[model samples]
Target: MHFDLADLRLFIHIAESPSLTQGAKRAFLSPAAASARIKALESQLGSRLLYRDNRGVDLTPAGQRLLQHARLIMRQVEYLKNEFTAYGADAAGHIRIFANTTAVTEFLPEVLAGFLAQRPGVTVDLQERLSRDIVRGVLDGSSDLGIIAGPVNASGLQVLHFSTDRLVLAVPRNHPLSTLKHVKLKDTLRYQHVGLHEGSTLLSFLREQVEHLGETLSLRIQVSSFEAVCRMVETGVGIGVIPESAAKRHSRTMDLTIIELDEEWAIRERSMLVRDLDALPGCVRALIDTLLPASGAEPPSNTPT
Candidate 1:
């Protein structure tokens, strides 16, 4: 190889972070070492690759051009490595996955169990983050794959609609809101709400629905995970709005109640995102094939009526 993969990898990190210090931290190299590698790469190409300013680093015309090609070359290298690895062959590799709280808690458990059973040697690192983090993780190379809510837009990643999940309103079993047959969007907003953090897609969707009704949802407390939101609702902190699938897990064991959000603003789609499916590691490929077969998962029975 005329240029080392490490060199291009470092460049991509620098390009994304735009800070030699931050990029070096992420790449696990000293600032001086990272700088020297870029300098050498620029020298070999006989071009100025970066412009440093008070603000941060900016890629020069040459740098931007190389980044595109470097990404392509890296994908090719990854695909080459994947080809030689066997199916279910204890392929040792890293797969960083990001998923929304609902999928992480409700859907991923069974999928992961099956995947690990087939490929025990493979390691799975999973994160429970919101949709934006999942998309950003793929773009930043922090995660290899992400599963999240609909309408996640990212230029650097390949997104697939692997599934659709419904969102519903959850309340304590004895709460007043639990009496509604099917909660309308307007009705749901009338109650004090317990919500996921601002990072969550559910929160954003709730905000949009409330706004469309010419009202604001009164969010009493914002929590990080869907589980926390459910716990809060169970404790009567306030009514919560979460994915129905997520609500189902707690429904069996807790005194919580769920109702369908009225027709106008109900169903939301969830999806799978990959940095580049063609460039996936063998273990990742196997896991994907098992968890998200071409048919995609059917809407789970847990969806609220």
Candidate 2:
């Protein structure tokens, strides 16, 4: 049996759209040509891959399996391309990192700026994602490394201790919670809250934690960044939960009071995650070392444990 790479790619596009014409258009192929390729692929596999209707095509069991394999293959292909992109005359090194909102907004920018200045040939693609999603992306070869905050469920990956931070409540100086030294999120849930915009990792994590407490989190106002969240909270429109660093920084200038969260999860001990460091490219390994400064202890082994 034989399979063509183009056919696999076309099939993937079709699986995503579930419409032959739409898939063909996305793949930059004529509808008839894409149909022929898929039909030929089905014939080669001796399986009927699609069930067509006026609405769209549905994947058969075999097609579903193929789609899974195809996606995995494409991800690996992309990983290969990403790893090798630095080798050409275009750049010296390239790496992709997935990190939580705290790491992206509070920590990484300054560190990455220094790294980029020293290695002008290196370019990084940093993305803000949930810790769980970051772990998944790193493990699946879709991302080179993940910087996670809070507890980490690290299995089948090399874990390195990174940094620690805290989450605290930012409230207007005269607000009800302003007098408190420490408070649980549940205690503040009854009050209107300012929040980061939708799709933020911190917002999603807060919602998940609230759901576990058998409550819902409603935002009085939503803003784009942590600074914006603090600024809104200062106006007395609502209180907001922000990083302790951000709360402190903003309190210096804004009329906001910082209250530590009386919860274990509020103490965010960060960690770095990766696959086998021994297997990564030299420049990528250098980046990992740069990100994880020495902590007066034995260095992490390049080998995966």
The number of the candidate with the highest TM-score is 2
Cα miss at 69, model 1 (Å)? Answer: 4.9
lDDT of each: 0.76, 0.80
Per-residue lDDT tens digits for candidate 2, residues 59-136, read 999998798677657654654565666454223466789988877887689878876787777788999887778988
Residue-wise C-alpha lDDT for candidate 1, range 52-136, written one tens digit per residue: 8778799999998888777657755765665566543336455678987677666787878876776655667888776777777
- True-vs-predicted CA distance for residue 36, candidate 2, Å: 3.0
- Over the full model, what C-alpha lDDT does candidate 1 score relative to the true structure? 0.76
Give candidate 1 misplaced runs (Cα > 4 Å): 16-18, 21-37, 43-48, 53-72, 75-79, 82-90, 128-143, 151-160, 275-279, 293-305
> Against the true structure, what is each candidate's TM-score?
0.75, 0.77
